[model samples]
Target: MNIKLSVVDQSPVHGSHAKIEAPRLTVELAQLCDSLGYHRFWVAEHHDSVHFANPCPEIMVASIASVTERIRVGSGGVMLSHYSPLKVAECFKMMATLHPDRIDLGVGRAPGGTGLTSHALAFPHEPHHGDLYAHQAQMLEGFVNGTLPADSPYSTIKVLPDSSPKPQLWMLGSSGGSAGLAGHLGYNLALARFIDPDNCNPAIFDSYAEAWKKAGHTGEPNRMLAIACICAETEEEAKLRAGTAVYRKLAAQMGQREDFLTPEQVQDRYKAMSTSEQAFYDHILKGYTVGTPDQCWQEIESLAYQFYCDEVSTVTVTHSHHDRMDSYRLLAKHL
Candidate 1:
């Protein structure tokens, strides 16, 4: 197993930290990840959430790429439905131009939000036409390969000043549909184990690999899994910290403002949960690797070996930025 590691700085804006400071922290973390031999650093896109500050992934990737030397930088996903395929290709191509070999384009099928927020970000035209993701993916491939039609209006136009050496494309998914699609298309797959906890069985990865073979793709498909990771010096300390982080995530999932509570507050909240609620919390947290350094390494190794994942992306969400940074440090050392 290669045991490559990546970071998805989701830009979770804590209640205490100034919203403006989130980007800086993210950049700093990216640089640190690069220096520590991380394979990639991805930023996620979100809007209308006090918890997350990143609304534009391309700009953020560019900024982080400018400061890092070796690490690949890209979006955890571009949330494809929100923009034109051509525009998405152009933006990432521009990023590839600047960073050259250090750029990736991970696309997601979902709109990434719901209700008025989704409406606010909706594309001008029907975003999801028949097989929209597949069509867009094909179009994007054409743009990257410079093989689109030459004379016809839409097909003929090419992304200008394209500096990309053909950006690596990956499909981001929380379910099997994305896995099958990515495999069929011969693109990389980024599985979010932390998102769809109920559906995160190792069999999903087996299905992906089998589908890749069935798709007749000559090369092995690149498979990645993102997991919540919290590592500390002691098992108790790690679990405590991870529990606190999980509490914050649950609060956010329940549409509450995240990061407003202190560690003590998190503990109190966790204590107030009923048995079923605690079971749910424990299940979600099970998707995470949290313990002492040895235990964390064991769990991560088990996950990678079992899933046959090419890389593991760790999203460290601790109350303290220092603790988050420390967790990454420990992970890098072990990974």
Candidate 2:
């Protein structure tokens, strides 16, 4: 199986130290990833979350595209429920015009924020539907294909220049519903293995492939799996760094959103946790691909072969940005 490395530029702020360098550190890491031969670099859209720095994925994509030459740049995904389909089409068209062959547009149905934050960003009176995502996706395709009515508000307004070929589009999902829809529609799939650890059975990918074939899509479907990957020189050090990530996830799951914790703080918190809490954290971490470089490569290869994936995107969170970059560098060498 072929393996590729990619990063989601969430710019995690893990503690007091991260706050001091998060801004410049994130950009530096992006450059490092580009130079390290990673296949793609994407950012997540988030708001009102102290742990995540990127709220506007479009702006972030522009910044990264400006600095990199070969690496593909795009959103890990844009939350479609929060914006108009026409606006999204125009925004990505602008990105495509700038970067030409190096742009990708990944769309997700989730709001990527809490209820209050979602309301703040969405249209005040816009109607919400149970199948809003599917509808928006169809509208986006129409806008891209220039099939909208000529007299309508969005008809005459073509995305400017339109020089670059339409950007490669992908559907992002953590569940089978979106996977099935993406396959039926013949679009690429970005499976969120990191988010829905409990439900990440190999059958999910099998279902996607079967649906793709049944839908008469003759081309091979491009399936990219996103996983939490942390590789270090030694297993002990990797585990220590992973502990910090575990602590942050636990805090979020427990509804305790506050300042980020340092490695020491994370260790202390883990020690003080009840046995049940520790067990829960351990269970979640088990699904993650973390360990020494050799071990990581094996796990990644196994998953890719089992799922018949075309690519693997690694999402890493280390206490130091340098460590995170180093992890990618190591993975790239093997790839």
Give per-model CA RMSD. 2.4, 2.3
Q: Rate the local accuracy (lDDT) of all candidates.
A: 0.78, 0.79
TM-scores across all candidates?
0.91, 0.92
Candidate 1 lDDT tens digits, 1-335 = 76888887787665456768887888988989999999999988887766567889999998999999999999898887677778888888887876788888998876666555666666444435225777777677677667666663676675875433667888888867777777776778898877775687778777778778998979777788888888898888888778766886677677676454666776788789999878877877887889888898788888888887768888887666677788888877765
Model 2, runs deviating above 4 Å? 14-23, 126-131, 147-157, 161-164
Best by TM-score: 2
Q: Which stretches of candidate 1 lie over 4 Å from their true place?
A: 123-131, 147-153, 161-164, 252-255, 258-260
Q: How many backbone clashes does candidate 2 have?
A: 0
How does residue 139 of candidate 2 score in lDDT? Answer: 77
Tell me the deviation in Å of residue 105 in model 2: 0.7
lDDT of each residue in 84-169, candidate 2, tens digit only: 88888888888888788888888898878887787677647643632588878867766766766666666676666562366678
Where is model 1 poorest over a 10-residue stretch in terms of lDDT? 122-131
On the 0 to 100 scale, the lDDT of residue 109 in model 1 is: 79
Instruction: State the TM-score for model 2.
Output: 0.92
